[model samples]
Target: MNFDASLWLIFILIGLATTLPRASFIVLGSRVALPLVLQRALRYAPAAALAAIVAPDVLVAGGQVEILNPKLAAAGVAVATASLWRNPWLPFIAGMGALHAVRYLSGS
Candidate 1:
């Protein structure tokens, strides 16, 4: 199959649109003092993004809501482990362990 230049330009434009904000922030640095309220709001960005990605997967499976699923349980354990241990790696291990344990028990 042949790729078209217009398609490449479209892809580049899409990528640039996504990247510009972050790149601009890094370049501008502290010169751009975001408002106090905005700064506070930004503090929740990571959790919000994490929830956006994870909430649906954990809450819905096979077109059914399964809030008590192992994957979600594992994620919670991972978050707790991370927070308590104050170590980055332990959370990953804990999450993986929890997920695998769930899957193993469920035979899925």
Candidate 2:
């Protein structure tokens, strides 16, 4: 497939935008150390990012809380699996399996 010139430019711009901040940290971190408070706070970034990514998908659908969302059910299964098995892969497998099982059973 042939990509248009504008599409190529957009792709390049997006790559640069994403790469620049990460590269800047690596380049500048050697010259300066971030404050201790900021360093501690940054530790939460992954959990915060994960919650930001997941909360909406689990709790909202069609711009509202979907009580019957299969995702919610699957998330519960995943959480339970994670708590019980304490394995990273098991939660993901359980979540996807629960999601598919719910969808198949409900025919939706």
Candidate 3:
């Protein structure tokens, strides 16, 4: 398949847009230290980002909050597993197991 010039230009622009900001941080971080408050705050960034990415998909279905969904049940199980076990892998295993169990029981 052949691509047109505009498509290639758009792809190049998107690649640069995605790469530049993150690259800038790494390049600049070697010389400049982040503020103490900012560094402390940034510690929560990964969890916050993970929640942001995962919450909607887990909670929402057909444009509504799906209280009875298997995903919701699985999320609860995952959280509980993480809290109790404090193991990263346990949460994932429990969540997937819960999801499959719910789906199988519900026949969906």
lDDT, candidate 1, 12-31, per-residue tens: 99999789967977988878
Q: Which candidate tops lDDT?
A: 3
Q: Which stretches of model 3 miss by more than 4 angstroms? A: 1-31
lDDT by residue (25-106, candidate 3, tens digit) is 6978778776999889978988999999999999998899989999999999998998899677999999999999999999
Better lDDT candidate (1, 3):
3
Clashes of each: 0, 0, 0
TM-score winner between candidates 1 and 2: 2
Candidate 1: deviation at residue 49, Å? 2.7
lDDT of each: 0.86, 0.90, 0.91
Model 1: runs farther than 4 Å from truth? 1-19, 25-44
Off by over 4 Å in 2: 1-31, 86-88
Q: Judge candidate 2 against the unseen true structure and give its global Cα lDDT, from 0 to 1.
A: 0.90
Q: Could you arrange the candidates by lDDT from highest to lowest? A: 3, 2, 1
Give per-model TM-scores: 0.64, 0.67, 0.64
